[model samples]
Target: FLIDCFVFFQTFFSSQKKMSTTSTGSRLYESSKAVDEYIQMHYAPQDQLFPYDDQYAPSAGFQFVARTATLCVESFDKFGEIREGETLSALDVGCAVGGSSFELAKKFATVDGFDFSEAFVKTAKKMQLEKKLTYSSLQFGETFEDRVVSLPESLNTEGINFFWGDACSLSANENVSKKGYDVVHASNLLCRLPKPKQFLKDCGEWVVKPGGLLVLVSPYSWLEDYTAKEDWVMGLEGPFEALKAELSEKFELVDRKPFPFLIREHARKFQYGVSDATVWKKKCT
Candidate 1:
């Protein structure tokens, strides 16, 4: 049953790629507006996200980042793969503003947060150095409010290293070249790459060590501006099917589920999205 469906979707989406040209992706993370919005989404309390009523929002602002890392610990424990004294390390690909990296640091022994946007990387490093950042966010039309984003208490940020990097060409990164991680986490980043297929091919093949895990979260929202339709990992069959096709060579699926999240654009307006999160264990050769 699943085989026939995947074939149909693959064929359908392949043809659709030829007909579509415009993309819905916005690659403006380098902009000041994008930086501020991410800052608020990463560090702001529930009240700022839902100014009218904090209780109305789901319990997942920066919590989504925390949950993504926890999924790794849970998976290892489920499989009895948790080493008692092994020094675990993690790589956070496309770690915008360092929310997910900081969250990973709480659990992993060391974490490397990598992103393409210099602005986002700089801000994340700044937060690590200064422990806080002040930014302005749009309330309605022109009204902007100044807010401060502080690092969460009790997190030892000493082991975290932030880097400006391109996801598609990760080999250029010095740390990635030195050694692979015990786990690699990439959230809401697949469909945005200019060449997502390359990233899928490299997940366990290069970045993750043998018997390690690769955690991915994505809404599968493909945009031609960011990625050519021909390069989308999720075709008509959706991300997981196409993802399995690419990753089956070196990885096997361990767990998958919906990971819902919210991002604040302004006091009144917010962007709500549900990303599918999946965990894969690299095959031991």
Candidate 2:
């Protein structure tokens, strides 16, 4: 029964990211099978935290699982932490697979996460409830290798809840509140939205509370498949300038830095890149 469940989860998760981009409901990473496979192989827990076994050696996947969160955490450290006595509340938008959300839960009293992909959201919910995940990775053309990932028991996960919703349409989500979160985070998600500008505009207006932290990180990998050329904030011209133009009215830029991460496709194959991150604090109105 467990094996059947794993097989079904694998197929469902894999197929979710394999659909056409023209669909209004399709998301960027959620519409790419390769990304789904990559997140499953890496972000899902392993038997051990660090220094994985031989088969999983070169566990560069940790960059996505922990390191991405580390970047956000470090940004907070350099900028600020939650208020001295107040409870922390955060929203992790575009929280693919929930790694960043889990990390945020370590600091916040409660962290709510949302993703456009139902498959990813379901897996994240299971990880929170069952504390374990079982899946297989593609070995070669027809070969597959099974693996099980266990969530760390020490992590305080009672405060994490994940849902399926559009980051671009957060105002419409009944579960999310406008200007309610102490920290609003979106890592590597800017370029993925169909209307990146609209997301930025909406975020500035209603998503983040006044005097809260708003962290935005992205590699600026704008693709026509995911976002239209006219809607891009980062085109051949550049990224940061236009991004500032969008958020400066409501958010003051505090820090701009580079966050490097790695994703492993197999033992021998990997992709490494640095994401441009900007830390913004919503102005007190």
Candidate 3:
């Protein structure tokens, strides 16, 4: 059953970037256009997942993030209660259009979102602004644009910020500042990388303060080797073992749950499952 579950997740949780102007080559432009189309087709819209109405709650990815967040929050609360008037900060690496960041924003006082794609960042900023307006306690039936223009100062209090960044090379002193974040989240990102152990270690240094939290959720492992360009290498045993070994030394394993979710990116009608989540905390020195 364990092996079967691993195989299932290896197929499931595997799920972007852009450049500027001055493109001269026709082939390059055509390829870029095709890639844009592909991203738009698969990427979930902000409104669809985080609508103005409460009825549109819980997208598949959103659900995963929420579940992970809940676990992280619970772990923190269980270990150390979040005192009143004390602000907590969180980092969402590979935030991808800021849906996860926005979700975390609701829980934390400050959230910094990072993504490699400039286009995704732009859309996420727009979404963030929209969310600010919608949830700003405006009167019923008030127009969002009008309310936003009229109450610009009110939008300033929203608890989220975003920036374009690479997670793999994130620095503790340079990028995030030393001992900065209280919680760090990297969901469904590790399996996409060529060397995930290095990535995980980098993440540990980037956001996790002493006694802070680290939560990672990925359906696929990054231990398997790949030969062909077309073949998707889903598991990497070395990287997985390396992460487990490294984190074990620094972090206390708090709560871990095996979540099963449909892999929407793989074009499967039936839900392709994966071993979904793990949450840990940096040991207090």
The prediction achieving the highest TM-score against the true structure is: 1
lDDT of 3 by residue, 118-194 (tens): 54555557666664322121122332111121123334427777766666567622545455577888776666544
Per-residue lDDT of model 2, residues 33-117, tens digit only: 4334634544655433233566855444345546656655666666655667778788888776676788888877789988776
lDDT of 2 at 261: 57
Per residue, candidate 1 scores C-alpha lDDT tens digits across 200-285 of 67776778888888888888877676777788887578678988988988998888898887766556666677888889888988
Best by lDDT: 1
Better of 1 and 2 by lDDT: 1
lDDT of the candidates, in the order given: 0.72, 0.67, 0.51
Off-target runs (Cα >4 Å) in candidate 2 are: 1-62, 81-85, 235-237
Q: What is the lDDT of candidate 2?
A: 0.67
Better of 1 and 3 by lDDT: 1
Cα error, residue 117 of model 1, in Å, equals 0.4
Compute the lDDT of residue 50 as modeled in candidate 1. Answer: 76
In candidate 3, stretches whose alpha carbon ends up further than 4 angstroms from where it belongs are 1-62, 80-86, 132-157, 172-175, 221-242, 263-271
Candidate order by decreasing TM-score: 1, 2, 3
Ten contiguous residues with the weakest lDDT in model 1: 1-10
In model 2, which range of ten residues has the least summed lDDT? 1-10
